[model samples]
Target: MVRALLSRARDMLDGIPHRWGSAAIASSSASGHGAEDAVAGYVRMLGAGVRPDAYTFPSLLKAVARGAAAAAEVGGAVHAHVVKFGMESSAHAASSLIVMYAAMGDAAAARALLEACPGATGGAPPPVMWNALISGHNRSGRFDLSCRSFADMVRAGAMATPVTYVSVISACGKGKDLLLGMQVHKRVVGCGMFPDLRVGNALVDMYAECGDMDAALVLFEGMLVRSMASWTSVISGLVRSGQVDRARELFDHMPERDTVAWTVMIDGYVRVGRFREALETFRRMQFCKARADEFTMVSVITACAQLGAQETGEWARIYMGRVGIKMDIFVGNVLIDMYSKCGSIERALDVFGDMHNKDKFTWTAIILGLAVNGRGKEAIDMFYRMLKASLIPDEVTFIGVLTACTHTGLVDKGREFFLCMTEVYNISPTVVHYGCLIDVLGRAGKLKEALHTIDEMPMRPNSTIWGTLLAACRVHGNSVIGELAAERLLELDPDNSTAYILLSNMYAKSNRWKDVQRIRQVIMEKGIKKEPGCSMIEMNGIIHEFLAADRSHPMSKEIYSKLETVLIDLWNAGYVPDVTEVFVEVTEEEKQKVLYWHSEKLAIAFALLTSESNVTIRIVKNLRMCLDCHNAIKLISKLYGRKVIVRDRTRFHHFRHGSCSCKDYW
Candidate 1:
């Protein structure tokens, strides 16, 4: 089969233009024919009494060099033929042979050919031949040899070409030898060969790889012409260097944007936690009608996950299908996560069910998703399903299992799983596992047991552990344990504003208004500011955000009016304001008003005004949804007959017919 293919390729090469012959050779050799078989076929051709010249050997060796390691070894057998044909002194043949050795990672053999070439008169190889050896060493990743070879060429009074500089500069990117790279740049300019587009690209890539974005940007600006490769290198380097702002700036200034550029910009924003900007960039990408690759959609969907933009994620899913981009395991997993985080567990389930390829990660993502969405039993069921699929559960899977028990207040089940993780699975518990167990005990009102578990921990407790205890303190109104938790938080992390905020929330829950005031004063004195509570809702492809008492939306009037009417109806339905959590130093009436204008309420009101009946209104909150907002949304869902899904900081609260999926346990 190899001989037949090679014979056909040789016959076709004889018929095509010489300029196209190398491409044909490459096309034929890529099929992975054995190196020994290729030589056997060639020898058969020669044995048939065909007279081959010096030029004939270059193309044949070119064919061998294009192949994999097995094919590259045939260079030796082909070299014997070249010697037989008395073409061993041919520079072209020698160059091709050098390339073949380098392709097989035989850098020393390639250099030996250069030194032994009869054409290297006066012990100085010409620039063309030197370039072959230099570039071949580079391809072999013997970059130091490439640089040394370039120096030898110059020292031997041989002129250097732009190709020489290009190859050497490329090696510096991997070697991280920025000084040698800059010296090459100086040499290139001195030779009046600077700014060759290929050399310039290599230089920019080198500097970027070496962590010198400033030099890269400076060189890029001075270039007479720039390609997308140039733009992408600098932008990518900037993103990795944590200067995504500069990357975005360069992205906006790009003369023409390609799919990679757009994707890079969106992902750069996502990496910097500027999720809104990423989504906005995706919007712009859609507006331009530029095509999106799988990578582009991955970044875009991740931004959706971060922002809880379900509608946008669904649109992306539809877009991918319309574009004939099939759902692979990776994309399937991302979609499941996006839906899960957006409080759309049913959609996540749909993605999980439709996926044909299920990796361990796929099962794990769905399990965690179910746990966070208040489907604890379902999550455990999925865990068993994963085990039945012959996939062993890892530590992450156990985290999901424990979290399932945590969200549903299954204290006994949580402890059992913790033990199972250590004994049955032989998975040593990390702090996270212990923290989950501690949270289980804490949530069950076993405050003393929770502390004892912390004391028994092999590792010192982290902020997350104390924070869990503090949160449980707030839940059960245990001022004594809450104080202990707060002191631990201060000792563990003096500057964390979360300790103060959680403390204040606990006091407010108990109607200790003066204590709340004191906590607020301390937070202000320490300049510790917790992020203000904010909620976001997506409707009609637009994401609307609101902060507490926010009136900044374009539909603020309608939202406020709708909220007022809804609250009035709720009050008629026997919904009294849960004023225990109202923290401001205000009168009773003012507190109720403030509660009415909470961020989630505004977002819900906006949805209530615009959405059709029966459409699920999804809201994402930056902080834990407040008590008043949760109770009011439950009533609003009942009063308006809408399914309301709100994903707060920790888990999903799905309100339907005046009940949350969490069953008041969260």
Candidate 2:
């Protein structure tokens, strides 16, 4: 029906006189129906021998700008018409032409048209023309050109309007040019254009993005009225500045909450590792009846992954389906990561398989997940599959593959991949990759080789590298290399409590009581307190946390009683406390008591008391599991005939039938 109307209009234009023909074309173009139809109507008018006037070209150019497919061709024809009529000198026609070219991502053509303007003189072009150029450059992501144009506009004595300031400020923000942004703010104030809401909001956003939170806050508080975007900018900026508490305070004070505002707050909590708070905020958002979009859901999924809240993450996935939100590649990638992190590798694989498209991140997440779960061979197989599918392996992907080799004690495979990463892939090994290699060698009892690798690294070894070596040395009882690693680690990170603790543990194992005491004294003198070990478990949609020897939960009595029973079973299974694992100079019984109160054991005890028999017990801990805890958990798994999954800071341990998925290598 629209096509019929266009045809009839064209026929009417053919019969109309020249003077009315141009008006007819202008009216048709102004209808804003469709760019193609509008251009067709103009062609009909031109065929009828009508000449385009100054006013006629602008509307035609606007119509051409609206159509992206045939825009260049139609726009060029319109340009020819402007030149033929000698109306290219008209400011209205020239500005429209410039904007049209810019809309098509042709900044070069836009500049050419601007220079061809009859009014182009020694001075700066008109502010409107300059704004069009700046807007075009800014739209095309040529931010530097946009800024330079703004400067030239100023030098030509052309006063900038609110529109001009908006584009320039946006360019400044995108370029991270705080100085230019501040100057733009000053110009806005001097012109009294700060009263403009758009100008005000842009200034605030610019300041915030440029890391000038103080300036951003000042402008934000001074605004007469605030939009959702205005509040979100400040809140997100505060979050980026690591002021999460301040961001939350502002979030609470918001008069109204939009999805973006809610997303910002939830994501802010996630950024600070406050997964519980992030989940709580997400729940509150749902209760408030605000619908979550893909961005919000992704953040919520990440929070769930961090907390191992598989139930919540599953619900979020269902919610997305219920709301008819299509899972794009980005959402799919995050889902893979979320499921993998939540200790459900099968579900993660399902998500990966279901994805219609997979990027490097998707592949990396799955491989890393499998590696951390101690499915090292599967991870390496996936890497080969990724290559077969023609996906380029990035630095992160190699890390996963190398980590797999480390977990599985495939030292030769680890070395092969390490060399391949640098030679075949031309990807330089980062400290993390080097650390993984060292871990592989060190865990295999190749202390000398590991030390040599560190010494041969292209970059200086970081604390993580030294820390990995020290951990391996402690595990294998290599006191000589362990001491050297400890010294180097301390020099790099003077207050690293983990290094001190590991070194002290190694000393204690070798009966170096005096050295252990001296290290303890240093720790005390430096006020370097160790992070208290804590473990978390999720049940019935609630997270329960337990610290060492904690008795805070209402069911603490039952948990401890269950722990006693598990300890008896462990003893029957040939379990004995490795007192040497304890770093302190204490009696053997004291060390045994200390091992009995580990946070992970307490968490498992609570799980055994509360969880159903057939279900897996999943626990997340903040620190590495001690050898005693590792041995006990393995025995508990066998005695109870239940599977237990424990994720420490470094890797996951799956215990079943008196064996670990890591094969006692980790």
Candidate 3:
């Protein structure tokens, strides 16, 4: 089959115009043939006496470079043939070798070919060849080589154009080399390469990636020619560098936003957990008739999951069905994530089951949803099923299984999966992986094990791992580990009020009143303030935000009054203020009164008062719910017979029938 295809390709190549012969070669080589078969077929062409010329090397090398498992080995043979044919010195042949080697991930060989070709001038490689080489290096994580090669192009007096500059700048982005990137920016201006859209886009991307939004905006504003890519690069960069407000401004200002621009803005909102804005932008994208690609679908699905927008997510599913998009691994994974987060794990399982093809990410997504959403036993079973199907679990898959173990308090199962990740899969644990493990141990009241896990981590622990331990300490009443975790968290992020609050709670829980007072004193001395917890719920397409003790709503008086009634009812039902959280010089009654206005409780009451009877209330919170608030939500869910979904900073809480979706673990 391969020889026949190659023979047909060679016969067709003979009839193509000389200028289009290279394209024809690339086209034929990319026709889904195996590299080994392509190689065998090419040799057969030579044996049949089809006198291979300069064009032949380009075609044959391309086939071998991308076709077979042994891409580089086969590519080297093609190079030898070119050299033997006395075409090695030809500029076309040399350029093809340069690109072929680079594409085959052998940059050294590409450089050697460039050095050996006498016909190769300083810029003889051409921009196409240079772009290929630089992009290849970037893909291979050889940022230094890419940067050095760009410099060599300039020092050798090669005319470096904007296309080439984009490749070089992107390479710097891969390296995260801010200083080197800035130096490249200087070279761009000094070499009179400004005003080029591609170069300007690269500059915007570089600065945004390096956390220099000021420079990124400056470049964006000064660009004489800005394409959609130029605008999207800056907008997306701002979003990624934690400047979401600036990103929104640019997104709103774009006179014409393509699908990429809209998707990126939605992604920015999703990243910051602002799903309402993401949904709004998605609606606007549809209004503008911009096409929703796979990425747009993913972002919208993520927003639906966070907001529990069943109607919107179902609409997306219907749209995807109508369009007949392939639902490839990424789309499938996100769909599963959406269904899982939206309190529809059955839908998540259905999507998972319907997938004709599955990759590691797909498995991980479904497993994670089940594990974290009160299906710990099912998560474990599905993981075993994955192994039965001979699918290997990567590090990400382990996190899901570990989360399942944590939620179910399956200490032994968690340890087994943790070992499987390192021993069976040979996958080294990342900080996220460690964080999940620590959470599992901490939740199980294995404080010693959680602490030991942090100490045994190969790399220095990040705030996330320590934060997990701190949260677990709160649950398990381990003051020592809680204090240690808080201290470490403060060292990593000094202004993190969550750490300070958690430490204060730890002290108060252990009856260390002086310590709690000292913590408040320290907070005052440092001029740091705890950001009030806020939750938002969407009703009739309008979002309402509620803060702790917030009285800013138009119906504030009514809302507060209704909240007081709920507090009175809960108080009669044996609810008590977990007074440790008050952290104020106030009377006991004042503290109890203050607890009634807690963000989640207020939001729940407001949602109940506004929405129709029996409607579910979905609220997104910026911080964790306190113990008292969690219990109150449980009782409210049952009393009102409403399903309340609150997505706090750490995880989701689904309250109904006097129970939570987290199974009382979170």
Candidate 4:
């Protein structure tokens, strides 16, 4: 249809009588790729002596802007002809030149054109010309200049039109200028443009993006009419302010929802760590038959990655393909991350290999994915490959590199990467980098070196840093430094349950019964509840969750019976239960029983009973794998000859043939 319209427009232009005032050459909106032909036809008409009028230059300039790199030269040529024709003083012609210059990002030329105006009409060259100036700058992301131009327009005794207010307010919103936005709001109201739908929406957006959610909500509520943009702006703003629940409430109340609206809610849930809710929202979107776009897919994929719900994520990927959503760079990057986090490293590699265009983020995602999946050497190799591809590593890329070295016991290599991050890349080391370095040193039993590194840090250590040191101390059984680390951690977070649990577990493993009892009593008195351990398995797009000794599944009877038989067979095969992992005051037999009913065991049992004999078993657990479960699963993998992948809080553990990919380090 667009081609037919362009053809018809050309035929009309060719029929012109080629005389002064015989016809005005006006092209339709010609401002996208390949409209240069229309501009050339207009030039032909001009040479044929169809004298141009005020309205002719605007269309000609609009048409010329479609010429790609040649637009600037053609626009200048057209401007010279407009001068020869004495249409330079026409407000339409001058504003068209401004628009043309602005489209070229020639801000100085655009300003020069604007300055040459106003003297012709005597006061700011009319509001339409000023509107063109401000809107051009706003479109160019020069929000500062847009606001300044709007202020100058007002000072020049020119009243802004609705178009002017909308562009300026949008500028204020995107520029994050709340004060100027409020002043613009007052002007909008004073000029009686507040009720205009476009102006009102711009005001709401201004308030929202400036982080004034209260004002945004109030203004939104008071609007007599609301569009999807109004609702989307407020909801996304609420999400930005960490009021995700309120944003969801407003989202629920929206009269209709589009893909962007649904995507904002899903992304909000993901940002707040509500992964289950995020996935559930995606399900609801599908149920409502709402269209999902790439943004929607990215949010859903991210939710699946966080939850380790590989099956659901795969469904999303397939759905995108069925729905004709292109596998662009963003979708590909996130897919690699999703598969990697879900312990599907082969799938991650496949996605990485399949991507035709790779950016810094694409390489970063795969590098981090490999690091977390216990493939440190491959991650390092990927990093060098990324550099070979001419991609400079960012802060996130370095984090993955440091993690790879830490897990692989390459302390010296980790230190080298850390130094390179500063000296070579000119990237300053953050606390996260420092913590990774400490973990590298601590895991290698260089406890004193880790402490000295901490002391030499440029900034104060946060709880995460202290916690990392304390964890290392527990691993090496250094009670004295462990005590100091624990004290520092406790001072940072008075009622931190993880710190208390780690200290108590360390004491229990060392047979310091008194210290364990003391920490346990303190935890009880403080009413600090430990995070209950849980594990999840995703099969056929349904996530099944299990807690310790859970009996809620329909297959509970068979699962428990299978687990019992499996444990017995492993025990007979020389699997001794590591009761030292039972971090509680219980009898020896009770601790062994408790270890048998752990959440991961139940998940494993369920997986075994429901899956095919040759199928790999994957589990995602919230907490770190305990010694008893880790040792038991290793033996289970070897005996059953099933590759089992478990993603715990810290990293991945790939168990096969009675050995772990972490090599017993993590």
How far residue 129's Cα lies from its native spot in candidate 4, in Å, is 5.6
Decoy 4 TM-score against native: 0.82
Please give the TM-score that candidate 2 achieves against the real structure: 0.79
- When 2 and 3 are scored with TM-score, the better candidate is 2
CA error at residue 609 for candidate 2, angstroms: 1.7
Each model's Cα RMSD? 9.0, 8.9, 8.0, 7.9
- In model 3, the Cα lDDT at residue 218 comes to 89
Better of 1 and 3 by lDDT: 1
Q: Give per-residue lDDT, candidate 1, residue 501.
A: 72
Residues 61-81, candidate 1: write the lDDT tens digits: 766765555444245556655
lDDT of 3: 0.77
Clash counts for the predictions, in order: 0, 0, 2, 0
lDDT of 3 by residue, 1-666 (tens): 323422433444432233333343344343334444555566567657776787777666655555422354445556656655677666666666676776666777667655444423443545555655676566556789889888777775567778788988987876888899998889889989767877888888888777787888888888887888878888888888878998889888888988789989999999998888898888888888888888888888888877766667878888987876546567888889888876678889999998865767888888888976678899999898888877898877888898888888898988888887889899988888888888888988899989998999999999888888998887677888798899899999999887887888777767888999898888878877767878777676566788888899898888888888887887787776776666455778887767778888778888878988778787878777777788889888877788988877767788989899777666
Per-model lDDT? 0.82, 0.83, 0.77, 0.84
TM-scores for the candidates = 0.71, 0.79, 0.69, 0.82
State which candidate has the highest TM-score: 4
Candidate order (TM-score): 4, 2, 1, 3
Better of 3 and 4 by TM-score: 4
